[model samples]
Target: MSNEVVLRGRIVTGSMDIADGVIAADAGRVTYSGPASEYRGKAGPATDNILLPGLVDLHCHGANGSDFSDGSADGARSAARYLHSRGTTTLLASLVTGSPANLVRNLSVLRTLTAEGLIAGSHLEGPFLAAGQCGAHDPSLLLEPDPALVTELLEAAGPSLASMTLAAELPGASGLVELLAPRGIIPSLGHTAAHTAAAAGFLEHAAAALSAPSNPTGRFRPTVTHLFNAMPALHHRSPGPVSASLSAARAGNAVVELIADGVHLAPETVKLVFDLVGAENIALVTDSMAATGLQDGAYQLGSLAVTVDHGVARVDSTGAIAGGTATLLDVVRTTVAAGVPLQDAVLSATAVPAAVLGLSSQAGDLRAGLPADVVVVGPGLTLAGVLRRGEWVAALAPTA
Candidate 1:
C-alpha cells in the first residue's frame, strides 16, 4: 500500500510563500515542500486553496464544553480532539488559579494527556500570580512564589510541564525562575502589578538565568502570558509590565503571547504590538475556555462562574473578561483583520508558539522532514481541511 500523498496549493509558511506549491508526505512525514514544478513525484490535483502549517497554540484552556481545569481526563481529551480538528495540531492545556490540591490534581490528569501525545504539555497560569491583577482568576487563590509548592507542582506535572505564569514582582520570583530554568520549564510573567523597573529586572534576570551556561537544560526563554491582559496598562509616568514585556520582546530576549481574539484587545492594539516588536517575538494564542465552540451560556474556569454573551466570556461575579471563545485559527483571522500581514499572523500562531514549547523541530512549519501537519484554507482564510501527520482530520468543500 502506498502511504504517499501530495497536496498542491498556494503554500504559506513561517519564512516563505509559494504561489503554486506541492507538499509530498509519506510515512507521516513531509518529504518535499516546494514549487509544484520542482516536485518530481506524482502530484495531486491543484487547487486554489491556501496550505499552511498546522497551528501551535501555546495557551489554551478548553473547547467543546470541556475545560482542562476540570481535572477530567475524558473532558480534556475531548477538548484536545476538538481543537485538533479545528486546525490547531498542537496546544498546551492551560489551567487557572486554584487551590494547591486542585492544581496538583489537574496537573496529574493533564500529565497523562501529555504523555499520551494528546497535548503538548501543561501550562500553569495561576497560584503564583499577583492578586491585584488576577483578572478572571480568584484573587483569594493567588499565592506568592513559594519554592516548595513550585517544586511539588513540578513533580506533579513531571517532564510534561512546559510553562508557568507568575507575577515577577513577587519576592521569590527570581528564585522560582532559577528553579524553572534549570529544568526546562518556562517561567512566564503575567497577572502582575509590577512597575517598569521591577518587571524589566525580572525579565532580564530570567533571560540571563535561562541562557546561562550553568543551566543544564537547553537554552530556554521566558514568555509573557497573554501580554497586556491581567496586568497594569502602560502609562507614560508609570509604565508597568506591558512596557517591560514589549521592550524585552522587541530586543528578542522574550516572546509575548497575544490573545488577538478581538475581545481581549482592540484591533489597533494588536497592530501596534506587531509594529513595535515584529511577529518573530509574538505568539498569538487562544486563551479559550469551555464555551469556546459552544453557544453563549454559562461556563466554568476553575472555580469561577463565567457567562458568555455575544461570544465574549466574562466572569459573573467580578465581570472581568474571562478566557476567549476563539480557536487559534480564529485568532489568526482576527489578527490578519487587524492589519497584520497574513504571513506574520500565521507565523505568530504557529512557529512562535512552537518555539515556546520547544517543538520547533517536530512541528510549527511546512518543511521537509517534519510532521505532515497542515491546514488547508480558502482565499478568505476559512479552514477547508486539516491534516495531522498526513492523516485527514477535517475535510470540507473549498470556498469557490
Candidate 2:
C-alpha cells in the first residue's frame, strides 16, 4: 500500500504560520501542503479541526497510571498509548534517580521499547542532580555524576540513549557536560541549587560550542527543565539559576519546560515565563503520572506511593506534589485558557521541545519533508483530531 495519506482541515503550524488547508503525506512524511482547494486527490473529510504538527514532550515523568521511574515495560507501553490520545508523537521516558542497578534495569527495558518504536529513548533525570534541591525525586538516590556510571548507562541503553539531566550546582558538572557533549547525549540543567555564577558557567560550555565570534551558542545553552517547577522559584532580586536560564533562552540556545496545568505554575507565572523566554524557547510538558487520563485516585510513583485528589498528585507519605495528572493536550489548552497566544502555545508543545533535543530540523515541523505526525485542534482550541505517520489516529469528524 502507498504510504501517502491526505488530511484536510485548518492547518496551524510553526510559531507564526497558520493556513486554512489540506496537507499530504507519503512514506510517513509530509509531501505537499496548501489551501484545501489545492488538494485534488482523495482527502479526509474536513471538520472544524485545525491541523497541527504532532507534539513532542521532552520532560514528562510518567502518565496514564504509569511512572517511567519504575522503567516497567508494561508501564511505558501504557503511558505511550495514553500520550497518543493527547497528540504526542514522540516522547522520552524520563527516569528519576535510583540505585545504579535499578537504573540499568530501566535502561534495558527502554532499549527494547525503542527497538519496537514505542519510545524515542531514555532521559535520565537524576543521580547527577543536587540533593538539596531535589523536587519529587528521591533524595537518597541523587548523586554527583560519575563518568564511569554515565558510560555504564550509555551501554545499557545502547542506541536509545538520547539525553540526561544534570544540575550545575554539583562540582565537576561542567566536566560531565563536556563528557556528554560529544556523544549526542544532551545535558540539561535541572534540580540545581546553583547560583547565578554557577549557571552561567554551564552556559559558557554550550555557548562555546555554538560560536562564530559574531554569533554565539548563547541561544543553544543546554536546556533548563521544568523552569519554575523544580530547583528554585524565580526571585526578582536573586534571579538565581532559573533567572540565568531565562536569560540564556533570550539568546536562543536553550528551551525551558513548564508544567502548564495551572497547579505546578500559576496562570500568571505561566504568562510571566512566556514573557521572559518567548514561545520558541518554551516546551509545554504535562509532567504527568499514571493518574493522568484516568480518574483522580491512588497510584505509584516508583517505590513511592502517591495519591491524586482533585487531579493533583502528591506523594502519600511526604505530602509532596509527586507529579501531574494532566496530559500534554490539557497543558496546551491550559496555556491558551491562561491567555497565552495560541501560536506560541502550540510551538511550546511541538517545535520548541524538538529543537531543544536537537531534533528540530527533522521531527518538529509540519512543513513538507517533516514526519507525517500531525494533529488537529477544534474551533474551541481543544484536541479535535490526530494524525500519526500519515495515518488518521483520531478525528473530530463524524467518522474517524
Candidate 3:
C-alpha cells in the first residue's frame, strides 16, 4: 500500500513455463516479473493467486448492478472496480440498442471518462443490428447501418471509441467498417442472420473495404463478438457466420469472441473451437451483464428487461440468451475443466484478447513498458489473487 511495491507469487505468463517468483512495479506499469532474487526493490507478497496479466474483456456489457449505458460516472466506475476485482482491468464499455440521441449521450459520457482514464471507451452494440437476432437489445432501435449515422457516432464517440458491433451482412455496414476502421475504432460483427453466403460476402467486403489502399490507415480487422450466442448455431449442412468466423481466423484475418460461460456454448464444443481455430485465435470473454459477480435476479441490459436465473442470464420473452454473469477467470476455469491446457486457457483470457484488440505489445505480455495489470490463480485453478498496476486488489490470502 506504500511505494515501489514488489509482489511475490507464482508467475505464469511465460512461454510454456511457470515459476514461483516476485513481480515488481512502480507507479502503474510492471517494473519486473521474475524470480524474487532478481527483483531489486521493496517487496510485498502476492499470495494464493498467481500473478499474470490483467484479464482483457473484449465483450462485456456490465456487472455489479451497474450498466455502462446507465449514464453515471459513479456507476461506470463501480462496474470497472467490480471487473477489476474479478481479474479484468481493462474493458470497452458495451452499450445496447437505444435512440440516436441516447446513444450520443452515452458516448459523450464515455468520452469524458476515457479522457480521464476512468474507463476504456465504449462499444456501441446498437442503433444498428438485425432485429431478429437482437437478444436483449431494444427491437425498436434496430436498423440498417448507415455510414453517415456511424460517422456521426464516431464524431460523438471521440477518439477513445474502442469497438462497434454490427452485422457485416448489412448493406452499408461494410462501408461503415471502412470509415470507422481508419479512426482506430474496431468494427465487431454481431446480432446478424448472415449465414454462410452472407458471412463470406460480408468478410470479403469487409476485408476489401477496410483494407483498401484508400483507407491504408484503418488497419482494422473484422470481429465476431459473443460467438454462438447472437449468431446462429454451427451446422454440418449450413455453418453460416459461425463457419465464416472460424475460417477468417484460419485464414489469418479475424478474431472470434467466445463467451466460454458454458451456457452460451457447450463445454465440449469449446474443444472443437480450439481444434478448428486454435486457442490463440479465441479470445475468452465474459459478455457479462450487471448480474455478474452478484446474485442472480431480474436485470436490465440497456432498456430491455432480462432475467438471470441459476447464474444464467437470458431473455425472458423469447428465451434467447441475454448475456453472461461470469468473469474472464470464471470462463477460464470453465474451459480448463473442459480440457484446455491452463496456459492456453489463460492465454485466451489474457494475451489472446489483447492481441485481437491490437494491444498485445502494450498490455498483453509481461514485458518492458506494459502496464502492470496482472492476476494470480492457485495451482488447482482457483483465483488466488489479483493486482492492478502492481497493487494487490483482491485475493484469498493465506490464512496461516
Candidate 4:
C-alpha cells in the first residue's frame, strides 16, 4: 500500500498558474506538479479549488493569544502551531524591543523552538530602533547599536538568529550591519527617522557587506521591515526611508515587507507597492501579536500593553499601531481584494519570503522534490484545507 496524496485544481506554482493542474506527493515530498494531462500518476478528481504552496512569514510576532516575546516555551509552541494550521508552514518567530536580559531570555526560548523545527528561525524587531519613530515599542527600552550588546544577543541566539531590524541613521548602524551580514543573519532596516540620503547610503553599505565573499548567508539583499510603517512618511522633498526602500526594491537590491492586513495600510497602498516594486521584491508579512485569532481585548506585546478593537491593534496609551491581528492567509485575501493579481499576491506571501530565509528549495513553490506543504482554497479564495509535509493539517468543506 502506497501512502500518496494527490490534488487537482488550478495550481499557483509561484512562477505561473496552470488552469488544470495536478500535484502528487508521497512520503512528504512532491513527486509531480504541473498540468494534469502531463502527470503520469493517477491524479485526484478535478475540482474548482486553487492550490498554492504554504506561506512563509518573515515577521510574525505571535498568534492564538500566545506571545513569543513572553519568554515561555509553551507560548511559543502554541503560537507556532496555530500559525502552521493557518497555512503559514514556515515563519520566523519575531520579538519586540525589550530589556537586554529579557531579549536574551526570549531568544534562548525561541532557539529551542527553532531547533525543533516549529519555526524557521527568529527575527529581532528591535532594541535598536530609532526612538523618535519607535511606534508601539517602548522608547525607554530602545538602544543605540552597541557592539557588546549585539555580540551578547548573537551569542544567545546562536545559529537560529535569522534577522534583526535596526534604524540606519543611528550611529554605528553600519557596523551592526557588518557584524550581522557576515554571520548569515540578515540586517533589516526599519523604525527610523532617517531622510533619503542616510537611508540610501545605509542600504548601499548593507548590500555591499552582504555581497562580500566572506558572508555565509544566502540572503544577499537586505530587507525593509514592514515598509512605510514605524518610519517617516514619504514626501516630495523629505523622501525618508520609505522612498529609499522603494528605490532599492525597484533596483532589485532589497526586499520590502508589507503588512497588507487592511489595518496597517490602505488598500490603495498595497496596490501601489505591487505596481512599484512587483511581487518578486515584496515579502508579505503578518506582524501579528498575541491578539491574533482571538477576540478584541487587552494583550501584551513585549513589555507594552496593547488593545485590539475591531480587528485593529494599538498601544493603549500612545494609540500607535501595536502590530497585526491577522494571519498570513488573511493578508493574502486582503491583498487580493486590493486589486493585486491573485498570482502576484500569492507569490509575495510564499516564494519571496521563503527566498529571504534561504528556504527556497525547501519550501516556497509547488516543485518536485520539495516538501508537500500546500494550501487548497475554494471560490473567492477562501481556504478549504492545508497539507504540511504531506499530512492533512486543516481540512474544511469547500464553499460554493
Cα lDDT listed for each candidate: 0.90, 0.76, 0.75, 0.91
Task: Write down the RMSD of all candidates, one decimal each.
Answer: 2.7, 3.9, 3.6, 2.6
Residue pairs of candidate 3 with colliding backbone atoms? 8-46, 48-384, 49-376, 49-384, 49-385, 50-376, 50-377, 54-373, 196-240
N/CA/C clash count, model 3: 9
Expressed as tens digits, the lDDT of each residue in 264-345 for candidate 3 is 8888988788778887778888888888877877888888778888998877777777888888888988998888877788
Clashing pairs in 2: 65-290, 66-290, 219-251, 219-252, 219-253, 220-253, 221-253
Sorted by lDDT (best first), the order is 4, 1, 2, 3
What's the lDDT for residue 181 in model 1?
A: 79
Over the stretch 161-269, how does candidate 4's per-residue lDDT look in tens digits? 9999989999999999989988878889999988899998888888888887876668788899999999989998899899999999999999999999998899999
Off by over 4 Å in 1: 212-219, 394-400
Give the residue spans of candidate 4 off by over 4 A.
394-400
Model 2 per-residue lDDT tens digits across residues 1-400: 7867777777776643545688889988898877776777877666667877888888777776677878679878777766776788888878877889989999899898879876777788888888777777788777777989988988899867777788987877887776666666667878887888788777667555434343211224467768766677667777788878888887776777789998998998888888877888788887777777777777887667788899888987778788787778788889988889878898888887787666776666778888788877788767776777777774211100
- Which pairs, if any, clash in model 4? none
* TM-score winner between candidates 3 and 4: 4
Per-candidate TM-score against the hidden true structure:
0.97, 0.91, 0.90, 0.97
